[model samples]
Target: MVMRWWSDRWTQSAGAFFLEKDAIFFASARDFLAGVLAAVVITCWNLAAVERNAIVQASQKPYQTLSSRYLYKTHKAKSGRNIHDASFRVYRSSPAMAELLLFEDIFTITGIDTDGKKFDKVSRIEARSEQFDMQLVLDVNIDVYPIARTDKFTLALSSTLRLDGTPDDGVFDQSRKKSLADKYEYVMYGKLYKYDDDESGGAIKIGVYVSFGGLLMMLKGDKQHLGNLKLDQRLYLLMRKV
Candidate 1:
């Protein structure tokens, strides 16, 4: 009888010990799960805050209309020079020699114009660019498109108006086909006749010259911007006011 009573007491002690171990295990598991949940909540909150900040920053940034790939230059006109007094001797030379040698292909492109001066002809205007502090002399057909002083504009030289970068047949289409020129107010067909690099104001400047019929354009600036231009290539000059 004494042995049986001792066995019962040992069984009770064993059961109590097992129950205490189970309670400790459950408590630790619950605490671990709660920590995990708290970490997840904190991480989600941080991500959401970051996204909200990004949206705010984007909204505050200025909107840019033109893509850098096709844009050749952007300028605000400082002043209008005297067209009559402005020498066209540098740009007046005929482009026929270059035009006669190359075949034409069209591709997508766009830009803006800044300041203008009416030349000897009522239909023509001579202009310059101001943004990059570069030397620019541009001649446009005022009869076709008029540009005033202190105007802000961008210019692009493109081979075609196709957005897909495919070459267009050298034919004018009046169809519903959308083109890069649609975004611009003034458009002209021209050929890049010359490209030159020279030192100006203690800096190296690259020059691009193009002729639209008899109208001419000379853009001289940093090479990083004008490096894509090719000589004797047919291009479309697109311009719009900002």
Candidate 2:
């Protein structure tokens, strides 16, 4: 399965960890196995990088708290097409903030598909946090349709962030260049996959949808709301410094 995925153009481009084509073109079984092992190791390493230490461990201590939120939206016509958007939020916040903002914030959105079929869009996010610097990390799993496509894939995304300003520094100020209003930048990465029932017998064709890169804005905020948070195929979110 790994070998076949390696041969796919999408997987190669998404992961981009394969050896040179010539190195594997006519390789022996031993070489193929080596390539598979290399790919697995590289993939795991990359995932760990995106997951970040904030998610797995925080300095010498576990995170003091966890906070999470989820938002899901849908738009469908009487035709046969539909658009769904969702986001999962996990950040470092005080236990009080987590309970006040997310613990009971539950709602659902329902609509009719283009085929006149009824569908429901439900989402949720949960985590814990602290007040000092707002150090945070998140792991998001989404099963939805990507932008400009008619199919759905499960996207696993993760990142880390920490608030570095002070209350007097205008954490909620939008006019200043370095204010909390600035884009919250982080390295974002995820893998995309499709469920296929083919000659491989209902195998899942997985590919690296996105790899590690920073300068990509993950979160932003105004005095009242976070903006420009539509990451990886329309994962929109709103946030505020608590």
Candidate 3:
């Protein structure tokens, strides 16, 4: 019944949009839409903090470095491919240093017209900025199914921390930063989602496990993790923030 209703609705919408007198209008609208789509930019939001906004902040110490490790596993698959597998670690080094360690691993990718294949690579991502700069830098390669290839581009990933409105004042809130620093050792879990065409595309969800609450809350790395997320795969991330 749901399928039938969807089909009927699509048919009706298409018919109405393509009515005999609507051809010219449809063409113009399509061109306008294409242009708008080209101009629209893609930004990744922090799903963890957004979804768990009601969770009380637990950190009260000064902002410091945290670390952890986990087994990275993929529980979701698409087309003719299976999930990927890997090991992750975040070392405890310095208060100013934030590191995400991704060990060597194999990932599966299924193309639009071909069988799935496996690719393996190693990488490390770190944020050295004392304040949020919208861009997060990392030295790593990522693989998303159907379009399997390392991100050879030398560009730092971008992140949007505040969800309420533009923070015209400053990037980091001192009180909030202190809370994160205090609770730096807390355990946190989050889900990463991929929205391909902004509001047009459905979300592709990925699970993330963080050992350090500061990583997810303080450094705000969760906001930028979506840069390497894939729509065709469900990623189970076991990560630490050090």
- All candidates: TM-score: 0.49, 0.16, 0.16
Error of 1 at 85 (Å): 33
lDDT of 3 by residue, 126-197 (tens): 332322222222222234212223211111111222322222232345555332212221112322332332
* Candidate number of the best TM-score: 1
Candidate 1 wrongly placed segments (more than 4 Å): 1-64, 67-131
State the lDDT of candidate 1 residue by residue for 1-242, as single tens digits: 99999999999999999999999999999999999999999999999999878756643432233232222222222243211111111122124312221211112112234233346343333344443444556676665556565454555567777756667764677996867665455777878888888896787888888988878878777776566679997888776654
Candidates sorted on TM-score, descending: 1, 2, 3
Model 1 local distance difference test score: 0.58
RMSD of 3: 25.4
Q: What ranking emerges by lDDT with the best candidate at the front?
A: 1, 3, 2
Q: Write the per-residue lDDT of candidate 2 for residues 1-242, one digit (tens) a residue.
A: 87787679677675554565545665776788899999999999998887675433422231222323332333333353443344334535455323222111121112113233222331122222221111112222223321211222112122212233222321234445432212211123322121112233353221212212211212111212111122243221223211
Candidate 1, poorest ten consecutive residues by summed lDDT? 82-91
**TM-score between model 1 and native:** 0.49
How far does residue 147 in candidate 3 sit from its true spot (Å)?
39
The residue-level lDDT of candidate 2 at 73 comes to 31
Q: What is the Cα-based lDDT of residue 180 in candidate 3?
A: 21
